[model samples]
Target: MQDKSFSPERQSAFDARFEAQKIAFGPIVFQCVRYAWKRGMLQALAEAGDTGLSVDELAATGRWTPYVLKVVLETCLSAGVVQLRAGRYQLDKTGYCVLSDTITQINLDFVHDVCYVGMHDLDRSLDAGKPLGLQALGPWPTLYEGLSSLPEPAKTSWFAFDHFYSDTSFPAILRDVFSSGARQLMDIGANTGKFSRAALAHDAQVQLHLVDLPQQLAVADITLREAGVRERAHLHPVDMLDPAAPFPAGMDVVWMSQFLSCFSEPVIASILQRAAKALAHDGQVLIMDTFWDRQRYDIAAYCLINTSPYFTAMASGNSKVYESTDYIRLCEEAGLRLVSARDDIGYCHSLLRFAKA
Candidate 1:
């Protein structure tokens, strides 16, 4: 797979205009390529290998009509998802990503199923500082609240998108998180208890408290029981959104994974302060999240940055894929000093370790 760089600012005015047109045409291009992907036209080209395939050939082998195949393929060609060589169409790197990349496909489906309709209310969501777009899905204030209630493909795609990033990181980060040999760990925002289960399995002596909303705790409880780690895992149903709600105290390790981005800066500060207050003498808070500025790849950075809109329009209206500097400052303001930090852990995520100053 080839990754090429295109620098339009260094080019002529006409070239820059052409680049702008790409953005202008992005919606239609996305839909057309998505169509090709779903219809298996891109897969046919991929299976055809370097020999490629003609639109007529793809139609004959598949259920699609030649005219429809021709339309989708031509749009894909313009989008650089497909290339035409000697009257044969083949998948480009972009097209291959759509068809074969797990993360890419998950993200594509998530956008289609979860955000496509709601995102149209982005302007209103921004103005109100609330997830006004969420009404399109259901009558929930945030995506997290409506997660379990989501319909069909939306629920499937949401979990797939959420799990893909976090699941891959658990194995690699367990050692770091439990490095202090914490006997009493608290998994704050324990959505599914996956991390809590992993923590129990990582260290036989450790006991973990899984904290989240009651509904979220219910989901996590089942998984923990199935994993046979329920004995060591204590479920604490707490609403972190409640300003007066205090975290479980005497915690040796307070762990939150992809959790803090669901709130505004002030709420994050409050939560961190509560965590700091709840910490034992040697306790540390470990946070694992994808920060836009910490990303090594531009593509990863772009995806992380773009997620801010989803927060604004679907999830919490004020949260975002926070920059590392800003996030660290927020933690520090809560009296938790950033003692150690590691970036590029399991894809685009960063692990931050903090202790009370």
Candidate 2:
């Protein structure tokens, strides 16, 4: 495969300074934008159409006072989210995206609800090799353990963030999975059974073994039952971190989508070793994730790079959005060989197929 590293052309000195300022004040910018959205300022500007609204007009129409309105709108103007024309404010292209784009909304909610507060402890978490920032949410050792039990907005944002990446790739993944002619498959870390349900829907004859923690499995059970595929699905509740827990044998395929990146490299190697032992001689393992180094575009790589801190602060301090080479190395240690790697499948994801060495 070709190296997909992102290398941008050299920027002008003026552009470099602008970029530096953006990075320096990114947190403040994020909070200001989030608050503007939450307070309905963005909506009001967007709804005001091309003519836009003045600070006094926005304050009179919305719940915000003039003081808050001026502060947020001025920030939005500087950020290019909104335009000031003839003393009136209107949504710019970016502001309209903030109001209308689903990805933008999901990313914003995820950052605000799940990562913003926890990020404060990132330095401490890094030094301790633990998700110390997770204390902002709960006392779990990792984010996965506490996902099901998170508070309202955090839980909602967490799942939204997770599913947003995986769900987009499911159609392509299901095709790849079924193409292997796997009659029995195991979905490791089958959160909410979305992939399992998709697999069952794609191939009626295929049986799925859904493995996740008990709380996650319960949620998956409900979803599978509601999807009317519970009969074809077997739920296994196990703590994957337990070294003694073995994956069931005789599996034709083992599918992990956006899963392994949740753990440190050592834990990933351990899990792959277990999968290797459980696989039949001809069976295959399909691993799908966003590898920052494999992204086709600079923006995708940029997003994944920023996401690493979420792992450090909130998910697991030891894990990250890894490069494909890292995963390949771990697979080698686990007695598995990477058979093939398919990139740019759906929404910035790559699929790696493996078999026992």
Q: Give TM per candidate.
A: 0.95, 0.95
Q: What alpha-carbon RMSD in Å does predicted model 2 have with respect to the real structure?
A: 1.9
CA lDDT for candidate 1: 0.88
- Model 1, residue 339: what's the lDDT? 89
Residue by residue across 1-357, what tens digits does model 2's lDDT show? 564543347778888788889889888888888888887888888778988898888778769899988887888888999999999998899988888888889989998899889899999999999999899999998988888899979999888988988899999878889887999899999989999999999998999999889999999999999999999998888788887899888999999998898899878988999988889889988999999888888878888888999999999899999999999999889888999999997789999999988
What tens digits encode model 1's per-residue C-alpha lDDT throughout 1-357? Answer: 134343733798898899899999887888899999997788888999999987678777768888898888999999889999999998899999899899899989988888888999999999999998888889987888777779878899989999999999999999898889798999999998888888888888999999899889999999989988889888888878887899889999999999999999888888888999989999999999998877777889888888889999999888888888877898889889998999888988999999989
Candidate 1 Cα RMSD after full superposition onto the native fold (Å): 3.1
Which runs in model 1 stand beyond 4 Å of their true positions?
1-9
Candidate achieving the largest lDDT: 2
